[model samples]
Target: MNTYDPAALECLAAIVEEGGFERAAQRLNVTQSAVSQRLRALEAQVGSVLIVRSRPLRPTHAGQLLLKHTKQMRLLRADLERDLQDLAPRSPGGARDEERISIAINADSIATWALDALTPLARRNLPIEIITDDQDFTQEWLRSGQVLGCVTTLKQPLRGCRVLPLGAMEYVAVASPEFAKSQLPDGLSAHNFRDVTFICFNRKDDMQAEFVARRFGLKRVSLASIFVPSSEGQVRAVAAGWGVTVVPELMAAPLIAKGLLVDLAPGFKLQIQLYWHSWNLESEVLNALAEALTHAAGQSLVA
Candidate 1:
């Protein structure tokens, strides 16, 4: 398009992220009709369809390109605002030079040791907002500009982003004592989980099954399972002897210490190496937060 319509590109991205024109309008504090008009104008300017209107909208490839560019623009704008505020000589406690740095992280990490890993930053008074979700999809939030940083399984960084390894998170197969005594076989093997039920965080969570399969050298977990979406509830169900589960070492540690759960295999473990992914921009806040995270990870995670 001859004219670079930042507002229109933003509206298009919101429509894709928020799932509807009306919702995007609400987010933009504008009328739904206005959002529609902006999309139509942009489509005419680009001479291509940007979206396919459905229950939850789907963006065309052209739309994704513009969305990526829009996100980069937003991140740059945030960095600029922070720099401008720094030049104003404003008070420290005020909003000057302070904008929320939204980050995506795994729920297990947030509820377990990761928060402690962030304690150093809190001690320094850094302002950050954490978004908890399945680690498998954490990178999506980065692409959508919903978060500037993420702890994700993807080793490589996303477009306009950089990645730094934060060290590995370990998980072990665990279950209630009663479940282990009753549901498990006399000598249980990973491939023999067909007889026992398993508790999973959600369909997207494959940690438990993957652990089993890897131990047995199988391609995948072929077992009966139950899905529990909540992080706390999943732990509770496993503790209640409803089924077996695989949980992070930090999450299972306290309960294991309290005798609420039993380790199926004392030494068997799965370690997922986490990385810090964020926009490759120079900002004092982001730089400070990154330093804090690196330092925290060094203390909390194994070398």
Candidate 2:
């Protein structure tokens, strides 16, 4: 196996993560010319084109493998930092941008328990970037090696990853009190559900259709939806009477308790079982993240 330069690998990660050669150079405290030279050198050494210089830069397959390799090295070094913190903290002299610990988590989890779970790590100045997507799609970030771990609905382990069940989060169909009373007066029955717009986290989110289908026993279900990319944004939209949404029970609970948001169907609970997938390495950073998420899930999610 040919050994690659660490600086070259950092250049690759910076370019992808920062989204441009200019930004990568700024992050690395290097000139744009230096960034291009390093990337070219790395590609020449590997004898492959690593990047596709498109509108938004993206890595080619060989580049993705190198990026994944870079991420694993970062993880190992992060673990080392954790271990050495008590003895001597590393100098914060150079570009720490590439040191970010990236994880893909469903937005619902981020709006709910994931942030609390990650508080300890964040407080200690761990560079963390959360990539949010639908629960079903978060695993793709891990599959592509863009993130070290992810919280997703996928149970089948990815190659070289370990899986941990984080319990099931119950999703409830909720809307503002006035909207429910005015529009869904019948409470999302088979006859009236079609009349209301369902607010979704994004196009990839199908929780609204899933909840309605399972609740009403329809093999095929479709919903008219407007997208709200953020979980908090979804809540705000529904609260402002934009539309009804299927969200985690915990997210809707406080509002439900406050009589701001009403649970449309009290009898039906849509539980999405969540799993933690991470690189199967004996590293403290990954282990801590897993433990924190698992513990928080046990308390908040249904067993």
**Candidate No. with top lDDT:** 2
Q: Which candidate number maximizes TM-score?
A: 2
Given candidate 1, what's the lDDT at residue 94?
43
- What would the C-alpha RMSD of candidate 2 be, to one decimal place? 1.7
lDDT of 2 by residue, 1-303 (tens): 999999999999999988999999998899999999999999999999999999799999999999999999989888888888889865544327667789999999999989999988787767788998999999988988889999999999999999999999999999998999999887888878889999988888888999999999998888888998999999999999999999999999999999999989997889999999999989989999999889988888887
Candidate 1: stretches off by over 4 Å: 1-3, 84-102, 116-133, 140-147, 158-160, 185-188
Off by over 4 Å in 2: 90-95
Candidate 1 per-residue lDDT, tens place, 7-67, comes to 8987887787678988889988899999999999999998899898776678877877776
What number of clashing residue pairs does each candidate have, in the order they appear? 0, 0
Tell me model 1's lDDT, rounded to 2 decimals.
0.76
